[model samples]
Target: MNSQHAQHSPEILVFDSSDALASAAAQRLAAAIVSAQSDRGVARIALTGGSTGIAALRALRTVGDPIDWGRVEIFWGDDRFLPAGHEDRNDAQADEALLSHVPVDAARVFRMPCDEGEFAGDATAGARAYEETLRSLTPDGKIPELDVHLLGMGPDGHINSLFPGKATLSERERAVVAEFDSPKPPPQRITLTFPVVNAARHVWFLVAGADKAPAVAKAVGRASPADYPAAGAQGRDGTTWFLDKNAAELLR
Candidate 1:
């Protein structure tokens, strides 16, 4: 880990199992959103999609819906460039898991442009449009400071759509970028860069399963972001790793 990152090491919370982790994350997320809304009148959160991520969203449903959904602005960390309503799309999974159960204002939900929209299959155009949408939310024309940015890490240590050693890792200016050749399928994707992710007041990584143990160890050990994108996701106010015992087992 570099000196800068070492100075703000992530807070680690380990659970007995993935189910326990998801339930805890869901409760914490609800509280965080309510707290943000209390402090600022509105809360913005970026969601992630994956087994653990979606499970957390689903678990949120059992929490009695304490959040004022209408006052919460939702965004995504990254999503495949598929047509709208595609089951594989992150937003669609999110809708099925949580959004549909809540009373969130439709206008406040900012889903990344789909492949069939105005951009129409052009990944770059879609990315640019999403970036514009993010900038439009801020008075300074910068990416909005999200209250919380939730992430799920791949076994290879990737975060969002940013795979290890990918050229997109070098991106510093653009808040969102198109991943034309993702190592994982769906091939094309749109993802928020490190700048936008780190701008969040809180970056919470929800990881589980024994398969993710090694990557969790490396990220917590402070590996270079180019090698482990999760290492690059440091929130301005706080960074946390919520892990299942299987995932935290390998952590030092």
Candidate 2:
């Protein structure tokens, strides 16, 4: 990690179980959105997809009524390049998990393009279009400075679609990029680059499972992002790790 990132090590919050982590994360999210809206009239957040990520959204549905969802702008950290409404798509999972229960403005929800759209099977085009959307929302023609950016770390230490040792890990110019050869299934995907993720005011990582314990330890220890992508995700204001006992077990 760079000196700037090293100066802002992540704050660790361990939970008794995944369920507890989800509930706590949801509460924190609600508070964050409320605080941001109180100060700025709107809140922008990026969502992640995975068991733990979805659990947090579901938990939010129970405690998020205090939030003025209509003024909240939603974006995804990454997305599978499947057709819209595909059960496996992150946006679809998010809609089923939380959006449907909230009164969020449809126009504020920025979903990455799917394979069946005008981009049509072109992950690169989809990524570029999403980048344009983000740029349009910011004065500098870069990515939007999200209020809160959520992420789920893979057992392999990847975050978003950025895998360890991949060329995408070195990306500094683009705010978004296409991942055509992800180690995980349904290879084609689009994801926010580290620059965009780091542009957020707060980055919250929700992780669970014994399989992730080692990676969590490495990430917390400030391992090189090229070797542990999660280590690269630091927020401008703060970075936090919300982990279950299983995930934090190896932390020193």
Candidate 3:
């Protein structure tokens, strides 16, 4: 890897293989969770949906060291407004791919409610409720101050439910928002707004594949937030982008 690749990668580490990347990320995130417990006696983390994010969760299951399951709270960065068992629901995916294998408390796992009749209303309610949950968990009303936020970037530069050219891109106050007309499939979704996403003590973006080359290039190369939503996504204390060879190919 060259200087630019080194610069744009995650703060603590990066990997080439999907499994290796996942394992490393999970271990680091777990370590962060443990550290949070040592420092403040509690840890709160936000998780994203998609293959990469799922893989990270899967990695957590096999981690050698034990995590303080009771002290940690898991929340989603975004979710598809589908029924509980729907294939596209982030909540379902997380449960199948990760939550099922962990020791996390059932009550502490905050998932968006999409089974209700009203999609928009459900999304709005879910966002507000998650915000309130975070408020109760945090010593203060602010977000991102918790331990860590694990994210996965789409090929088009979307992160969480915040897509390019969408109104959620500019959200400032609310921790979460209901997004509509997303270009990606399953258009209707709810996501943590930029304010919440960026408020974390640590933010990590796991991006891979040739399909993501263009977005990765624009994100770190041009540093234009609007053109590349990932560029705008940052952690309160720090932000890192993890990529494989193919994704980093266009960084020049």
Candidate 4:
């Protein structure tokens, strides 16, 4: 199960319960983002969508802290290619959970525009537009070496919109691409390709529950990238995996 890509394996942290772990991770993530902004003047982060990710967001809100929300630029790792207000939109979930609760400058919050009446229903155009935005803001021609990229793992080892054995998993050139035929459903999505995701400075995965244990073992045990898409996710600078007892039960 050895993988060269795992050179970025993160410091693993395990907790007793999902709620406690997600909450703590969220608070730490908020603090980390704030600290990065203080040290570097700006911090760009990629966020995920799911119950676990939402729990982490809720933890951020419950924990008392005054972050320089204005200096933080938020991005999504992937999104459902639905209308902005759609329940399945990652943007919508994030806004409800944390974004709307903060005072971040509206201009700094980069959400893909799904409402545009472009052919192919605007997903491709949105992805390309987001790539352009990244180009305009990043110091180099590369995608922003994001301060942090937060993610959640599906029971089957999926992350963002990239599912195991899917053709989208092989994409490299596009920072983001429109995903179709997803194994999870609501097939159409837009996601940050591996090249873009692996470009980040730090990537943290938050996971919980026994249902996700097998995939967790796969991810942590050096499973092949094709069968376990989570194995393909790596942070250029560092990577970390946060797990609860149930999810980490199989890890020897």
Question: Considering lDDT, where higher is better, how would the candidates rank from best to worst?
Answer: 2, 1, 4, 3
Flag clash pairs in model 1: none
Once superposed on the true structure, which residue ranges of model 1 sit more than 4 Å away at CA? 1-6
Error of 3 at 165 (Å): 1.3
Comparing 1 with 2 on lDDT, the higher-scoring candidate is 2
Model 4, global lDDT: 0.82
The 10-residue segment with the lowest total lDDT in model 4:
1-10
lDDT of each: 0.92, 0.93, 0.75, 0.82
lDDT of 2 at 145: 82
What is candidate 4's lDDT per residue for 56-77, written digit by digit as tens?
9878887766678899899999
1-252 in candidate 2: lDDT tens per residue?
121444486799999999999999999999999999999999999999999999999999998449999999999999999999999999999999999999999999999999995899799999999999988986877577899999999998999999999999988888889999999999999999988888789999999999999999999998999999998888988999999999999998
**By TM-score, highest first, what's the ranking?**
2, 1, 4, 3
Worst 10 residues of 1 by lDDT: 1-10
Regions of candidate 3 where Cα sits further than 4 Å from its true position: 1-14, 117-121
lDDT of 3 by residue, 1-252 (tens): 011121234353446776777777888887888888989887888888878788888888878766888877888888887777798887788888888877788988887767465543566776677677767764766553646888888888888888887777877777778876878878778788777766677788887788988998787764656667887766666777777777777775
Error in Å for residue 252 of model 1? 2.0
TM-score of 3: 0.89
TM of each candidate vs. truth = 0.96, 0.97, 0.89, 0.92
- Relative to the true structure, candidate 4 reaches a TM of 0.92
